[model samples]
Target: MKVLVVEDERDISDSICQYLANEEFLCEAAYDYHSAMEKIHLYEYVCIILDITLPNGSGLDILKQLKDMQKAEGVIIISARNSLDDKIAGLKSGADDYLVKPFHLPELSARVAAIIRRRLFEGKNYITLDKLVLDIFKKTLKLDDIDIPLTRKEYELLLYFISNKNKVVTKESIVEHLWGSEMDLADSYNFIYSHIKNLRKKLIQAGSPDYIKVVYGMGYKFSIH
Candidate 1:
């Protein structure tokens, strides 16, 4: 999944991105308020790590904008000031969670995972789609209790499909979610097609139904109905 880290400090942002990258996320960084605004407007993320004190605006205002836009991305406020007022203010403004600065990176990752699990998988670590079962934390999938081997990209694609089940997810959005802004230079989505084809084949070979369906002139949808 994609995660946006809005922090003014280069070192902090770098560390956060590096850490989360290892945890299987395409991390995008915004150095200030303007960049954060632009990213939120242009892209969708699974979670956003926002700093309370920004270069030109308060993070609370950013949270407000998200609410105004009715974005579903979860927000976690990180602030240097450990004050009850700030926590309440951020929570009131619609932050899903808050963390004081000088926190451990593991704790940060755990919090991010929790928020994403709640947002994407409805707070479950495992997802069961009829005969198929996916363990989010273990990064494993099974069909009728038989292990289904999958490459990293295939697993991610399956997770993305299930996350937006029954909705048309465009090829462009899939590329962005998988590769982030770094894939701007790519010219085609052939790789995406190949991965999806292989994933669908594997699941079906493992005795699961063809859940991924192609939508002509649009993209694809994962549906049981």
Candidate 2:
């Protein structure tokens, strides 16, 4: 999953990114309000770690923009102000969860995971489609009783495809979701084709139907029907 950390404190932001990265999440950091806005506008994240207090503007404003834009990315407010009012305001502004500054990294990670699970998997730990079963927490895919081994990138791609099943997903969006904002440095999207090819081969070999469909000049779609 991709996460954007909107924090002014360098130490806290770096710590969160490091911990989450170790847990296999792609993370990006924005120290101030303007940078945060730029990222939210440019990329899509599974979860956003937002601080209420920013250098030039309030994080609440960012939350408002997200709501106005109807972005589905989950938001978690991590603020030093632990007042009931702040928590209520954050929730009312569309934050899925709130965490105080002096919080443990593991708990924060768990909250982020839970939010992603609820948002993407409908609060379920596993997703079942046809004979295929995917364990979100375990990051494993199986065809009935047979296990299907996949690389990290393949697994992320599969999850993205499943989440948007039957919908056309552009290659640019796929790059942004998998690599975060760093995809700007990528030379080409040929790597996306490579990953898709491998994923298709594995699923086909595992006795699963070919659900991934190419959209010619546009992109790809995952359709079960």
> In order, how many clashes per candidate?
0, 0
Candidate 1, run of 10 with poorest lDDT: 179-188
lDDT of each: 0.92, 0.94
Q: What does each candidate score in C-alpha RMSD? A: 1.3, 1.2
Q: Give Cα distance to truth, residue 69, candidate 1, Å.
A: 0.7
Q: In model 1, state the lDDT of residue 25.
A: 75
lDDT of 2 by residue, 1-225 (tens): 899999999999999999999888999999999999999898889999999999999999999999999999999999999899999999999999999989999999999999999998889998999999999898899998799999999999999999999999999889887887776636648889899999999999999999999999999999996
Q: What is the TM-score of each predicted model, taking all chains together?
A: 0.96, 0.96
Error of 1 at 93 (Å): 0.7
lDDT of 1 at 131: 78
Per-residue lDDT over 60-147 for candidate 1, one digit per residue giving the tens place of the 0 to 100 score: 8999999999999999999898999989999999999999999999999999989989988889999998978999888899988899
